[model samples]
Every structure is written in C-alpha cells, then in structure tokens.
Target: MVLTEYLSKEALEELVDSFSCAGAFELEILSPDGEVLARSPKVHSNKDSSINKEEDFIRFELPAEAEIFVGGEHVGTISLRGLWRTGQDSSSTSVGVKDSSNLALSAERQIAISPAAWVELMRDVVVRLCDLSKQVRSRVEELSAMDRMTNTFTEKKDLKEIYQLVAETMVKVTGTDACSIRVFNEERTELVIMAAYGLSAKYISKGPILLSESKIDREVVESRKCVYVADERTDERVLYKAQARREGLVSALCVPMIYRGQIEGVIHVYTRRPHQFDWFETSMIQGVASQAAWAIVNARLYHEALQAESIRRQLRLAGDVQRRMIPSQAPKIPGFEISTIYVPCFDLAGDFYDFIELPDGKIGICVADVVGKGVRASLLMSSTRSALRAHANYVRDLPALIKAVNFDLWRESEISDFVTLFYGVIDPTNKTLTYTNAGHEPALYIHEGKIRQLDVGGGVIGISEDAEFSQETITLSSNDVLIIFTDGLPEAINFEDEAFGRERVYAAALEAWGRGDSADGIGKHLLWEMRRFAGLQSRGDDLTLITIKLQ
Candidate 1:
C-alpha cells in the first residue's frame, strides 16, 4: 500500500517541504513501488528542474523506518529523489548504479553518501516525518472538536443540555466508561453535579462533594490543570473509594474548567479498568474543559441579565409608587410660592420631598434623605414618608410631630439605618413658621438680607426612641426666601473631585434671591448652577431641593 493512502496530499507535501534545503532542487517523496506520492514546491530558482514523467526522476531506497505495517508485513518505506532530467556525466562518471533518471555527476555531490549510508539517512527523516504526522492529526482532531463545542455554545442551547452534551461527548472522545460535569455552587464550597453519563444513579447520589473534603479536586482547582489518578483504590485523593468501586471506576482523570484565571468547574472521566491517558486525550479533555468554562460564563451572564431586567421592572414600579409619595407639584400655599425638584442619580433614589396640607391654611413642608441608596434606601424612604404623613396632621406641635416620626422610624429601622429630616408647618394667616431639623441639612432662611441656618432639631431620626427634638419658630417677612435641600446638592462632586459645597449652595440661592426671581425661578437657577459646577461628573447620590418664597 502506498503511504499517500494513509497520509493526505497536504501531509505528504508537508513532509517533503520540511526536507527542501535552500537553493536546492525540489525533493519528491515516492512510495516503495516508485510511484510519486508528494512533491515539494520548486524551492530552486529555476522551474527547469520539473520532471516530465515519474520514471525520469531517480528514486533511492529509504529502507524501512518501520512506520507503516499491514497484515504483519512491514510496508511502505519512504524514498526521495530530485526532480531533474535524467542524465549521466559525459565528462566524469559517478560511482552509483547507472540509471537514466540521474542528473550529471555534479548533482551526486549534493548527496555525498554511498547507497547504504543514504538509505540510513532517509530512514531517520522518515521516522521524524511520521512522528510529526501523528502530532498534526491529533491537533486537527482537537481543533475540530473545539469548533463543534464552540458552535454548540454559540447556538445558545439550554445550559443543562450543554452540560449533558459535554458529559456524553467527553466520555465518547476519551473512550471512558463514565464522565461527570460539575460546577461550583453559589457559595463555592461544594461541587454540584450538573450532568453525568454512564454512571449509576445510586453511585452519583453519594452526597455533596465539598471543596474541603477532596484533595483531588482541591489540587485540580488550585493547580488549574488536569489531575490523573492511576488507581482509585490506593489513591489518597480518592475520597469516595467505596463509591468508585461500586460504580466500577478504576482510573480517573479530572480537569478544571478555567476561564479568566478563575476555575469555574471540573470535568471527571473514569475508566472501568486502569488506563493511562495519552497526550491526545489529555489535551482534548483540557480543551473541552475550557469550552465548558466558556459555556458556564455565558450561562451565568444570561441569567444575571434576566435577573437585572426583573429588578428593573420592580424598581420602576416601586419608583412610580414612591414618586407618588412626592406631591405632584409644590403646594400652592396662600401668601407663599413653593417650588421643588427631586433628581435621582439611579433608577431608584433615597431622597424624597412632600407638601402636606395642614389644618387652617397651614402647609406642612418636609424633605428627608434615607441613609443609603437604591432599592433598599428607597424602600426606607417610602416607609419614612408613610410614618411622617401618618403623624403630620395628628401631632399638632412641631417638636412632638418630629419626635413621634423619629420613634416610629427607630422601631422599624436597623441600628445603622436612619433618616435625616426637615419638617415645618407654615401658617400664612399668622405669617409664622414652626419647624424642626432632625440631623438634616439646615433650611437656609434669608430674612431681609440676613442669612440663618435653621439647625435646631435633634440627632437624626431612627437611632434612638428617646431622641430629643427642638422647635424653632420665626415670623415670616415679605421677600424672605427659604431653601431646603438634601445633602446631595452641597456634597455634589466636580470632575476634579472637589465638592460644590454649602458655600456654593448659599451663593447660588443668594444670587437668585438677589435677582428677585420667583420661587420656581430660584429653584431652576440653583439647579443650573449646581449642574454647572458639577460638569460631566457622575452623581453618586440623589438630589432633592425645595424653594419657598413669601410673595
């Protein structure tokens, strides 16, 4: 049988090309029967060396490299000869056998060996070529499997289905009796079986595989490579010897599925009898492990995206509900202009503001900020809003009202959780304001060119049930403006990480008041100045502002 039948045209040509010396005649590898199998490129500058017929090229015996065998007979020794016009030296005779396929005696100089020595030399080259062929075929098989696995993952098959496919395919590829696909549980403390093939249900139900219990898996995970056990009976790493025996497992190979330097999972292959894995099986299984890791990562990302979408929907619903807690527009109190804006950095915000209509032409204005952010903080803000609203009309005194709200919040909130609140009742008929600030940003009161921070309340609400609160009463004056805001406004960061602090807040509000802007106009001007100072910087918290002017 010809070697070409066993090796592809490309493979045979590759064997010849490797032997093509620079500035030399192209080499032709021929079968033992003198049939041409492969020819290297015309490595020589001249194309004149192309042979017109197979007989025209002289062939030399390579002797058996013992590479190919059929039916107990050593077969197909490789041979090489130059692709040149058959010739003999007219001026000087060569010592080799006279064949019409030979070039002139000058070509014989390139060989520089006897017929026997040349055969020995060709034998060595043939051995190396066969070894290289085996390696190339192994890599090709591995790459083909990898491509199939990648496509399987890209198709977005169900993650469980992919796990089963990988388990079955790995067992088939490695010719193992059983294979199991396992991934770390959420806590990373246990390896849960995702898929198993060729294993009995009784054996698989052997209990949890903890990372702490198995030295074998720990080594695989820590080493980030394949671990092989020759005998399950004697191996100390085999934590389940009895189970392995029941399952008819002898030798096992375990490989870690690693992606981005993190080991995601493990794939185990077991043979019923002791069997050592070759390079081909080991490399192929490692490739399978890597592909498995990729599938795992993709599956996790997909699930996380689904979870994020669900949370977003719930947040929108919650935000809508909490937004209702904010008055649709600032309360239109007689003898006063009220303007308010609530800006949230995220979909859900911790900041909230409300205008409660109290008895007898009195309007209750409150702005509060929960201690944290996001859904948790937003929920707390909602709770605080309910508690404050519940007591706002019932408790007539400003200090008593704040104390009641604080006690309620303290009863319901965690030790670290609290709300900073500013609540006030403005009686326009009497031109009097009764207010309390509970560890909140002080209300900026501008009365006839005099600036005062209404900072009288108490420690923040929800920390202590017995927290004391103090009330401050002031008589309203014409053209006086009051600004109440959450800490986000003054603590707003700029690109340089500097804060647009209380000074800036005071300046902006003072400038707008000086310009004789209406309450709504002043709120807009303050927001514009805040945005200007915090140019292109991302806010980490929510901003809530309320502007009140005695018109």
Candidate 2:
C-alpha cells in the first residue's frame, strides 16, 4: 500500500476544495518532497490585486498541522492560510472575509479579547477532517494493491520476468530494504536464489543454503506458513546471522509460495531496522507470493509450447528442401517411358532419386537410400546425391563412376552413415542397359513373360575407402519393362507381423505386366497392393520405385 494508491491526485483535489470552502481560506496539499498535489481556489490572486497593495491585511497559518496517512504510511501534509482585511470596517466587500468578518472585527475592536481561542477551534475542526480522510485513503490503498497484484500475475508470462516483478512489488508495498525469492531444487534438498532486488552482488553470492541448515526456510517449506523474525541478529532460527548483521538487515519476513497445494519456494522481505510485521503486511506479502507461484508455472508451460512449435516449423522446412532435391517429373527419353514414386514415413526422408541426361543422348538414373531416418539421414542422402552427380559426369564406366562416388562419400560421411544405391545408363539407340547395384535391391527385368533379377555390383557406399565395384550389361528386346525399387515395399508389415515379401512383389509386377499397363500404372498398382497388405499399419520406412518401359 502506498500514498498514491489511497489518495489519488483527483481525490486529493476534491478534499482540498472542501477544506478551503469550510475554513474560508486557501489550502495547499504538499507531498514530502514539497511537490504541490492540490491547491484551493484563490479569489483575489486570480485577478489583479496590485491596486489594493496599501490595504491592511492579516495573514496567519493554522497553529496545528493536519497529517495525512494512507494504510499506515505517512504521505504528506495539509496546511491552511487565512487573509483578513483589517483596514475596512465590518462592511468590507473583500472575498473570504464575509464568513470570518465577525472574528476579525472582534480582534480589532477590543484589545482584551484574543483571536487564539478562535484559531484553536479552527485547528480542531481541520484535524478531525484530516483523520477522516486518512481512514478513507487507507481502504482505497489496500484495495488498489490487491488489484495491481492480480493484474501483474495475469499479464506476465515469463518465469524470470515474473519473479523480478513480484520481488520488486513486495519491497515497495512493505517499505522494506530489500526482497528476494528462492525456489527449491528438484531434489528438494536446497533453496536456490531466483530473483532479488536492492541487494548487493556480494551478498547474493552467499553459498548454497541447505534445507537442513536453514531453520526459517525449512519451517516455511515444511509447514507451508510464513515466519517472521523481528531481530535477525538475535533470532536463533536465522541461519546466516553474521552475514545478516554485516548487511545491516535487522528484520525478515519469509512467506511460502504455494501452488496447487504444494509449497514451491519462499519470498523474503528484509527491513533495515528491527520491526515486527503486522497482520496486514504479512498477509499482503503472502498474497503476492501466491500469485507469483501461479505465474511461474504458467510461464514455464508457455515456453515449452513455444519451443515445440519452433521445432515443428524447422522440420517442415527441412522436408521441403529434401523434396526439392528429387526430380519432380521423370525425364523424357526417345523410345522409352519412365515413371517414379517416393514416399517418406516422416517429414524428412532418407531416400532420393535423380535423372541426368548425358551428352551422347544417353540418360543416367540413380535411386539411393541412406541407412537411417530423419534429419541426419536426409543430410547424408543430400551429400551422397551431390557426390554421385559430380563423379558421374567425368567417369563414364559404371563401375569406375560408382567407385569414385564411394570414395567421396567415405571421406565426407560419418562412420555410422552408409548409402545403398542403384545407378544405370540407358542407350536407347544401342538397345543396351548398363548398370551397377551398390548393395541395393536387385532390379527386376521383365521381357516376353520372363523375369530376371539383376544383382551385380559391389557393397554399399561409405562403408570402405577402397571398395571395388563391378558393372553388368543387359541387352533389351522389344517390349521390355524394367523395375527398380527400395526394400520398403518388401519390408512393409501388417498388424499380424507378416511382411509383404519379394514373392508378393514379383507376383504383383507379373500381373501388371500381363495386363499391358504402362510404366506409371504398374508402379502405382504395386504400391496399392502393398498398402492393401499392410492394412492400417503405419509405414516403417521410406518407399521409392522407378520403372522404365522400352516401346
């Protein structure tokens, strides 16, 4: 509770108006710093009073002072001054003299009668009015403090900021030297200082306060009640009595911060002189601590939610960048039709594919899958794609190009990272397909109702620095269909723990080929069959497929 809370400027002005009217004189309300808060009406001063300079006037102040109090806090003083016209008779036309003309005339007409008695009566009346104003202002200040505390708790949403605000506000309301808040450790074995105001850095750096050693703090935590010490130096319950004396802290009030039926911490208010905390002061501090607990809890929750949202946004951005690395549509080659599909189980995928057209009208195709999932795996996949593309341009031999890509991957990748890739060069004019499979799923070649599995290549990339690779060539006849896929299709499992194995894939591909479906249609049909087999089970890995049909 403070002065401004009880007696606002507007309310003080109204009081000044009432006092001036009753006393028939001017009044001014001055703060402790001599700043005028309210002033009564001055009739003659508002106009030109220089013309009447020679007129005799009696000016005097009230004998008694009227002290103002707001919730036990002395705010300012109210003074009264009177101006009486002594030269004129009782018929004087001067303002503010009409009401007190008889008293002035009595003092002037007789030397035996004194105006001291009349001044004493006026002082009594003003003192009574001032006492009444103090009572009213006290109530107003109490209510205002409570309202402000409630609003502060509702508005602030950061834990550290809320702690600082609560500590500072408590110090102001209680008129204490300093305030501090300390929260319990997670293990409930110690109290750690969280926020403080009006305290020196050296004082705050006092070593950790163990709960067992600090009696007052332990009492507040265990009993969930406030404890007060009027003399810190003499109280046996004070833990750091020597340090408190050194800091000139004479009194302390410790209040528990309870939230959801559990005591979380304690707020301590320190006074420079020995003083007993009254019921009003103690209750006000406890109220502040209660609101502070709620604010601290809510702020932490808000921060966690914000962090989760930020991570979600980053994942979305990474997924978009990874998708763009893959070809949007299959490249168009003369006498060949190609189609592809890629599905990632999560936001970011470990699988990627690309098609690069060489200078001799031949096209290079690549489909690779990293070992892991998520962001790390996606990063490795991107690096592998760049290395393969760079080496494929210069190294025309399938085995040599793959070996160069492997060396680059081994040099750049981590020990746990590896990629299984299948790359091929298609020469439509020669009707020959040259390819190397680096430990990937074997490519299926279907021609004239016969199926051939091509599995001729070295191990996966990024496993060894000097691993050798080999290539295989196959001649394509009329109406030949080639299917390249990752292991996701065969490894897809249902609720019954059954995998959609290679046999099922072969059967589906055979049926699609017999139906005379195009390359796109065949790839989609196989994917649909796999989904049907999984039946409500989530995808366990990334799925990718590339199909080429020679017309």
Candidate 3:
C-alpha cells in the first residue's frame, strides 16, 4: 500500500534523500509499555516545510523494543537485547514475519495464512520475544542473587559459615567457576587464604603471601580496588594465567575486602570462559565484599575476647594461690603487742608484710610495696618475702637485714620489678626500736606524749640491680608506740585526690598514744578515717599498716 505517512524530520529527510522508491513499507513503534504503538499515514508530503515538524513525528519508549513512526504509520521495529559478556551469548533461533494480508481478508477470502508463512512468522516473533525475556531474566537473577548473598552474610556470624555462603552465593551470582577469600594476618602485613570453593584449600592456606611483590594479590591489595580480566590470553599482566588457562578459566574478578578503612583481604572469582566485567557486576561484588569484611572482623573480635576472658580467669586463680601464701594473722611476741592489716587493691596485690620473732627478745616487722600490680607483681612480692625471712634469721641487726633483702630482691626480680620497703626490729628489753626505710615512707613514733617521724632509709631496691641500704633507730620509753607501714597508708587519697599527709598520721598517732595507747584501735581508726575520707569509693592502691606498742 502506497500511503503518505508522517515521519520525523530526520527520518523523512533520510528516506527521501537516501532510500529508494518504496511501493509499500511497514513502520512500527512501541509504547511506554512495550506494546505495538501503531499509527497510519496522515497525508503524503513532498518535502512540505509548512507542516508542524513537532506534531508530524511520533516517538514511543519500549522496555523491550521500540519502533520509529512517520505521520502515524508503522515502521521497522528496533529492539535492545543483552547477554553476559561470556562467549556463550551466541545462539540460533527461527524467525517469522507477520502476514499483513491475513489481517485485511474477508472471512472466507482471508484464508488462513499458508501453513509455512504462519509458522515462519510465529516462530520469528516467539524467538525474538524469548531472547528479550531471557536477557531481562538474567539481569534480574543476578540482582536477586547479589541481594541474597548480602543478606546471608549479615545473618551469619560464624566465619566458616560466612566463607561457605560467600563462595556459593558469589559463584551463583557471577556464574564463576571458582571463588576464594583471603584474609590479612594479625599484623596485617600479608594475605592468608581463609576460604575457597572449587579451589584447593592447600593452595589457599599454604602460608601468608606478602603484598609487595605478589603479582595477583598486589593489584587488589595495593589499589584497594577491584580488578577484572576478560581474556587471560590477551592480558599479559595477569598472574597465574597459565594455570587459569589450563583450568579453563578465561575470565576473573578480584574484589578487595576492606575493614575500618584498611584492605583486609580480597574476594576472587574465575569464569571458565572469556567474559565481560561491567560496572554493575563490580558494584555487586563490592557490596557483598563489604558485608563479608565486617562479618569477618566481628567474628575475629568475638574469638579474641573469649581467649582473653579465659586468660583472665587463670590469673584470678593464680591470685587466689598467692593470697594463701600470705600469713593470715600476726605472730605473738614475748613482751611486745603487734597489730597488722593487709589490703590488696586488685585480685592480687604487690604489697606484702611479714613478722618474725628473734631469739633475743626482739620482733622484726617488714612492709614492702612492689612496683606494679597483678600476677607479675604478686610473684615478685612472694619471692622477696621468702628471701627476706630466710635472711632475717641470719642477721640480728635491722639495717643489715634490710640491706640483704634489697640485694636479694634486686637480684631475683626483673628490671621493671622492684620493691620499696620499711623494715624494723623492736628491742623491748633495751627500750629501742631500729628501722631502715628503703625508699619507703617514714615510720611514726608516739613517745613521751610527743610525735616524731623517722625518714632515714636507702634508695629504692632493684634500681641498680645491686644496691646497699642503711637503717635509722629511735629509742622508745615506757608507753611508747611505733607505726611502720607501706606508702599505701600515708599516700592514701580520697575521691578529691587529697592525700592523708604526715600531719594526719602524726595526729592519729598522738590521739592513740594519749587514749590508752591501743595499737589495734589506732590501726583500725586510721583505716576508718581513710575510708571515710574516700567516701567508701574505690581504692587506687593497696592499704597496709603495722603497729607496735611498748608497755
């Protein structure tokens, strides 16, 4: 049929200027919904320049296919089809064109399309539609799989489960022949394979591979970017291309897994045939890798915390053992009254005290503060106590005993481990109490209704690893009392960070010596004052006190 049809200015121009005389030509276009948007020719135009150019041309949008129109007449259909860049895109199909005469035939003369033409046209339409449908379906499937893979990673917490899911889901989404995930080691200096599918674990987990020179790993690791290879044979920079080709791998994608702004590992996929990797696929892989990275980090953190808890429990047990080693009560002296209080700041304390009576009517009292807290500190304190007690029996003089203990402590402990000590020997028979303060706080004496502090002692033990110590003595009369303690007592502070200074210690001593001179009451009163001053809050360090009263 020779009908005048409206056409776009450009199409009409092209047909008139470029195409041959046409007795009849069909034109078709699609609507927004992909249906055939048909229109007939309005009138014949011999290059009429007066007609509205805007109104003469018709355009339709089709999700599957579209056809251009001129003056409302059908034209050739145009379609956009897509396939994965894989070499498998080629296919064969039978095509048939519509029989236009059948539509205009009278009931009888409109003989059914010759069986051959009918089949041809039907087959053509069906095949085209099927191809379009398949392309759409493939894209939808990929998107669905990407979403599902991300969901699975978020729901799963176990590393093994996550790895398996990642491998399977990624392979399905990308249609890859194999997949693997490699994680960075603790120091984050190298990448170690953590999981794989369709790949040997031995190859993956052999050892951590350094990033500096690793051809394949370095690309993704250094870039913190995704890498893709469409045809290994054509890409000279690809690592293990020979192995990949031998294994039928023609395409690959590597997505780096990042955690907390660092590249933790990479997710790799391999296709058995040459394929195209586009922005969409790269985005999908990165989305999945991001979730996987967070999951791996969370799993590792949980595992590490469990290990630390186990270690902490063991330390608590060790602290209990150390506590058992300390004597619970003070030893009785022949003619002296003694009271001692021991407090530990943590599960185990670095501070310790020991009381030993000599054969010549004398009592030795020792209070020491180890430099640190916890198991190491407690162990060092234990060693110091044992060595000091052994040497106490050999040295009758307090100064010599302290010097020996300092030497032993310095020798037995590590460079960082040291002790500050206040050691004293009370001679009730001669009314004299001698003491040595090895970097320790001065002792307070309440005698003749007066208060005095003895501040003479040697430097901290273990500083030089071999140091000597000296002693200071105070002659006590009847009704005199002496207070020997670690710095924990005088340095004790309240929540305000105020220390109970020497003035307070002196005042407490005077009050006790005046009020019946009760050593036990004085020690208890001092602790009570400290507790009240601190408002029953946490004590930052150990609190210890040793008191001796002369009758």
Candidate 4:
C-alpha cells in the first residue's frame, strides 16, 4: 500500500532540494497519484519508470514532515509543513494518493503504521479532498447557470422581457431564495422596482423609492458598486429597516447595474443566514449584473429604432398622398400662355398651384400655401383646392369667388391653421385679369418691361373665422405677363442671411422680362435667377410660381 501528500510543484522542488543537500537517502517522489514523479537516481532499481507495474516490489508514499524512510537502495525524507490540503490533521499517518486521471485522490491506504497517526491522517486527507472537490464543482455549476441566464436575456429582442430574466438570474446565482431589481429615475429622483422574485408583487407594485431617503439602497447607488453585510443584526448601516426585517434578511448584497457607463439600476440579493461573501462571489454576481444591464440597453435601442423607422414610413406615405392630390397637368387655356413651378420645403408640400380653364373660355389661376408642413398641412391644402375648384364653376366674379372660398376654409379648418391664397380669373378675349388675394404676398406684373406689384388683399383665410377678402382688377396687354407667387421666393435667403425681398424679386422679374419678349422666355429666366440667388441655401418655405400672359 502507498500513501502520498499532494504539494504544488514549487513546494516539492524546495523540499527535494533541501533533502538532497543533506544526503540522507536516495529518494523517490510520486505524484498525488501512485505513479513516481521524480527520483534521486536517473533510473528505477527494479521497476520501469514509464509504467505502474504490479511486479514492482517498492512503492513510495507521501510522508509527514520530519518523517524518515529507508529501503534496499532506496530511501527518502518528506516535509508536509509547506503542503496545501483541504484542512489540517495531526494524528493521521496515512498518505493521500492520486491516480493518473487526476480526478480524485484517496487517503484510505492499507499501509503499515501506528494506528492513531494512520487513522487521523487518512480521515483528514479524505475529508479535505472531498470538500474541495465539492466546492470546485459548485463553482462550475454556478457559472454554467449564470451563462444560461445571460443567454436567455440575449435571445429576447423586446425590452420588457429583460426584467424577468434579470430577476430570475439574481435569485438563482446568489442562492438567496429571493431577489429584486430596480431602476433609478433621475427626473423624479426615485427608484422604481422593475422586477422581483420570492416577494409579494402587490406590496412592491407601490414603488418609486427616493434614494435620498433609502439608506441601504441609496448607498449602493452612490457607491456604484456592490454593498454587502454579513449580519444585519449587528450591521450599523441597515437602519429603519422595516422592509428588511419583514423580508427576513439576515445578510444582504446590493449591486449596482450599469449600462453604457450609466447607473441604470440595482440588484438586491438577500439571505436568511449571516453570510460573509468572498471577493470571488461578489465579482461573479457583478459580472452577471453587467450582462443584465447590457441586455436592457440593447432591447431599448431596438425598440426605439423600430419606432423611428415607423414614423419615417408614415411621413413617406403622407407625402405620396399629397402629391397625388395636386394636378398632374396644367389647364390649357387658348390665347393665353401659362407656366408654373412648385417646390416644397419638405417631402410633402403645403404649397399648391393650379390652372383651370373654365367652359366660358376664362382661366382660373390659384397659388396657395397652407400654414404648416407635413400631413396636416397637406390635408388642408387638398381640401382648400377641392372647394375652390367646385365653387369656381359657379362664380365668375373674382371677389365673390375668393369670399366663398374663405368661408368654406374657415368653416372647415381650425382657427389657428389657415391658408394664404392668391386666386384670379383671366379673360383672354378682353385680356383683363381680376384677382382676389387672401393675405398673400404681393403679386408681380411685368408690363412693357416695367415691374408692377399688387398686394390688395385682406387677412389670411381660416385664421379669424369671419375674415373678409377683397378683389382688384387689371388688364394685361399682348406680350404682358402676370406673375403670382408665394412668399417662398421673396423671403428666400442668401448665404449672407439676407432675404431676396420683394424689391429684389421685382427687379429680377423686370430684368427677366426685358431679356426675353415671349412669356416662356421670361418664365425660364425668372426661375434661373431664383435658383442662383438661393444657391446652397435651403428653401425656407414652399415655393409656388405661376406666370400667365395674354398673347
């Protein structure tokens, strides 16, 4: 039978060197397993060193410090003082031995020795190895459970699911029989319990804890680390602790969970026994808490991204609908030249322009800008245009037609939201232009190479429900042009932040008309001038330009 004491290689080397210098006897050192590890001589006396053979007569075993041994051509001394074991045992004479597998080492050796020392050494070695093995196994199992919990959270995409996962992991990893997770609300300066296990849900539902008041919980948050207490009964920090008493917590561990460098939450693990946790245990739990924090952040980001994409898609749809509402082609009025350009500041334009050739050979021209942008503005613009077109067939008088349009818009739209319009009818046979403006920008008229402006209109329509509108008339001659436009053109800014005001717009029109005798030539030149003036500057509003000439 053989007995052995397992020492780390470094400890063994020191002991072997000390014994060799003394030259007491030839020595054979074996592993925790019965296999000989090293020997004073280069080769074995009778047995092959490569294999553990039953035919070998000599077997070496670990001996206690100060112990002596001698044999035929083989002898040794061992020191157990520096050796590490699960625990200490003084009386035992038996030695512990490990097999080649390195899994288990046994001290129950059938060796010849004094009964008291033999029995004691065997008992101590066996018990220590067993306990150490169990501890290692438990640690591995705990780590495996932690991995499973983190994986479960990572598998989920929704933020709501993370609460349940974190709570379960905390309770399981701590072995505390109960656990809870909470978040801090900086705006309200309160802690909101998000999830809990092994506790009454009804009691915790009434949450929102003020950190400034909660001594234990707030301390954990402020410290930004794990807080632990071995015994709440004697701990000075745990005070006014009615909840801790009710929860039957004799020991507690509170760890702060951080996400993206922010203190997002805290996890509480409670135990009934007075427990002093080691650094390894606290660090392991903190690692798990960090995983929970990351999971929560990822879930929230995914949710927000989905919401933003949904909003963008809705805006795109609204833009498509608004575009379909506008006329695709301008009305063709014989003996009159008409051209228009409409540009929106946003994806969906509130500005709209249309030319309707009436059955009476008169052309109705409209350029309107709804007061806002997006779906609401587009809807209002669509409604206003529809109402005007329906009423245009009934009223030939420009003032009456505008008054009727205003009544319809004010009745249909909210008081705060309104439309600014410039509407008119062109009788080509008489070359007469009559227009009614609704608080819109002054219309420009370029005649005989001279620029004339008209701003004869009342307040904005649909603003004050009882707003009045008036009309003005002027005659256009052959080769004379009438320019109806939204404020987008005149109010456009340059890089210097200066507005391309009415003065500049009027000058551009005169210059444009003087450059070309035909209305088509003038329209092209005006647009070119505007584009150049507004270079690199975003269009501040919806721009609608309509030019009509009686030729």
RMSD of every prediction:
8.7, 12.1, 12.4, 10.2
Candidate 3 TM-score to native: 0.69
**Model 3 lDDT-worst window of ten:** 81-90
Model 1: lDDT of residue 551: 89
Off by over 4 Å in 3: 1-169, 172-174, 205-207, 214-225, 229-250, 259-263, 278-280, 357-361, 397-400, 428-431, 493-500, 507-517
In order of lDDT, best first, we have 2, 1, 4, 3
Highest TM-score among the candidates is held by which one?
Answer: 1
lDDT of 3 by residue, 1-551 (tens): 01112223344334422211121112333333455333223222334333223332222222123343322443344332210111112122111223222223223223354323332342244345434555666778888877777667667768888777887777777666788887777787777776788865544544456776456678887778888877765577665555556556678888998989978788888777777877777787788788778877877777789888998898889878887876788777555677888888898898888777777767777888898888888888888888888998888766667777777777767777778888878776777778888887777777788877776778877766457666777787767777877777777887778888777777776777778847798888877776776776577788778887766
Q: In model 4, which runs have C-alpha deviations exceeding 4 angstroms?
A: 1-155, 173-176, 183-194, 197-200, 203-266, 272-291, 356-361, 386-416, 517-521
- Which 10-residue span in candidate 1 carries the lowest summed lDDT? 59-68
Tell me the tens digit of each residue's lDDT in model 2 across 443-531.
Answer: 89998988899889999999999888999989998778999999999999999999999999999999999999999989999999999
lDDT by residue (398-509, candidate 4, tens digit) is 6677778788888888877898888887877887888878888878887787877777778778766566777888987777888888888888888989888878777777
TM-score of each: 0.77, 0.62, 0.69, 0.68
- Between prediction 1 and prediction 4, the one with superior lDDT is 1
Over the stretch 510-549, how does candidate 1's per-residue lDDT look in tens digits? 8988999999999999899989999989988899999899
- Candidate 4, clashing residue pairs? 3-62, 4-62, 32-98, 33-98, 91-117, 92-117, 92-120, 92-121, 93-117, 93-118
> Candidate 2's error at 545, in angstroms?
1.8
| Candidate 3 overall lDDT versus native | 0.66
